[model samples]
Target: FVHYIAKEMTALPVGARVRIEGLVKAKEHNAKRGTVSRASAPEGRVGVKLDDGGAVLAVRPENLERIDDGRGGTRGKGGEGSNQAGESSSLPPPKKKPSSLEPKQRTLKRDNAILREFDGSPDPNLLVLYYHFRDNAFDCFNSSEYHAQMIRYYESGLSVRLVVPRKIGNNDYFLVGLRHSREDKNALCEVAFNCKRSFSGISMLVKQRCFVCHRAGAPHCSGGCRCACYCPGGCEERGRTDHGRLCRLVRESDVTVEEECMQLL
Candidate 1:
């Protein structure tokens, strides 16, 4: 029931293609974000039919990013259209990308940066961590609910598995970071502690470095077995390669670590 400022927004055309960030379910009209889908309403509050034929949703215009611009020209957010004068028609800004001259992907970067606040061990500076609560722990939570909660914590970007970890005391708790492979493989990393309340009381983590690169910022694990970190970007190769050598480590230690991670939050 929110009304957008008429001057700042316009209806999208039917058949226009838009890309939402995550997965959107059919029953959710207010799903804040999702992937490519077709618009059913062009001007009013954005409603789209997901490409998968799974569900239809009425999304906020701001949440609907036009990938096709509907005029056949591929214009990204901060594209040259604005410079053309008189092209200032109402269409959501193009898909955001990182650039100084263009609209920046602030949301994407912010989500990736959430891990920066956690000062625990296992190297908090490694890769970006996106947490996901699953199965029974998330039974009552729908995609819309999940998306809303995530926005409260992180923005939006590459999704990773965030496992609920064990609690040591009233204040200390850890989260498990997982990376998935295309072949259904999973890697596990034991994240350092973040205070359950204000995140101000992190317990000292003994494993402060990545098992792979042996540098700080060890924010990843190998399939729920062992935790190791790779330096950002060019260093990922070493992280994965090193994990292969320790594939047996998870099997050996999982009796304690893996079971804790797999348990319901």
Candidate 2:
């Protein structure tokens, strides 16, 4: 992995006119022309300030192509002396990426624990909590932070009514009245401000059921997303098409395995 980066990277000189090329993580940066702002940054990458804006981005030299006279010309020499026009561009590409070495993995154990804990058996009141916050699973799943804070508010046990609204992002937080009181207000405000995810959502109730038939505590999980469950019989097959939609979205989600484990409980 280190060899691939070392072989491809050619440091760009400060003030060198270059065009951002190659697959930048943020798609918008590709093909954007920029001048080398700093010859080097903290990391072993060149820093370029975009021609359109003042934001300096640290990019690997391999992702940049040199512009000869401010106009698109030969491929960048990466400041390695000089090269013929298209000399660097002519080489066959190698199939290597930082992400390739560490592939994504599912968090089944945590998912199972969450589903079996809070979202316990189809209680009439709890409903499908997972569905409510499926879109922002990461945010709402951090309720643990809120729990600890609330306990500390009274410095002992305090009687308080609960309002677990399905919708967040609105200013309708239940603690607004006490958002400004000293010692009292700040604690509430701090809890609200620090924990924005109210997070937000996607937790499994204690009693999990197959998304297909709602069979209590379905034994099987959809292998693709590992989020939904299935009954022991042909339930997995029966819900293939319907579940596929959500499955693909979950698989594509950029959430890390660590985040998933934290969301448990």
Candidate 3:
């Protein structure tokens, strides 16, 4: 019969302290007895070998001792060497928990007065215009200047809307509400008035309508009317006869003065 020992128990050093109070089992072994002319073998129990062959049961933990010389004293059972040290020395400190009020402090504050004025308006068109300008603070003119211009236009009975798409380029911003008509829309009117005052040159591209009229033998009608050239019949000939008939027709029509002026331009 042979006794067994655990693998961990066999790993302990010879002098290491341990508590091993447990039952002991017997073991058997065989050996040669005499060596003579005719040798005889003897068979009997010798000692016990633990299941872990590297360890012997004959040695017990009680026989161990602390060996101290110049080095540090040897550790006893469940001593400092059993638990490794210096593991977490370089680890960082735990982070602090964030406060709930921190988010509220960081939130941005909007101008409530402007918001309220826009909110109180009943017209959906007005609200849409407000959002368009409000969202594009950098692209649109400054809010103060835009509001002042809007008030002035409103008081002038123009009922005009500043319609600009969100992604309109900088050059296009000045042309909003003006490009649709070649006449008195704000952009065109501003440009024409500036040109007349010699504040800016009337470039050929900007005065394309005038150039077309001149090329079509209607030079005198350049600034007067677009219909003089753009009307149903092509402008191929120059004549007082066609001119007088167009003038009479324009005067008799029921179109508004503003629309009539645009047609003329």
- Ranking according to TM-score, highest score first: 2, 1, 3
Off by over 4 Å in 3: 1-141, 166-265
Per-candidate total of colliding backbone pairs? 21, 18, 2
What are the models' TM-scores?
0.20, 0.26, 0.15
- The C-alpha RMSD of each candidate to the native structure, in angstroms, is 19.2, 20.1, 41.1
Off by over 4 Å in 1: 1-15, 20-43, 54-56, 65-111, 114-265
Candidate with top TM-score is 2
TM-score of 3: 0.15
Candidate 2 positional error at 200, Å:
5.7
* RMSD to native, candidate 1: 19.2
Report every candidate's CA lDDT: 0.34, 0.40, 0.25
Tens digit of lDDT per residue, candidate 2, span 1-265? 0011111134355666776654425658887877787777776678888888678988766456555543422334553323454245445446656453232221111133433443433432332333222353422222233323333433432323222211121111122111111222221111211112111112222124455566554653546444445775588887666555544544544432212111221
**TM-score of model 2 (CA atoms):** 0.26
Scanning candidate 1 in windows of ten residues, the lowest lDDT window is 195-204
- Which residue pairs collide, candidate 3? 225-264, 226-264
User: Backbone clash tally for model 1?
Assistant: 21
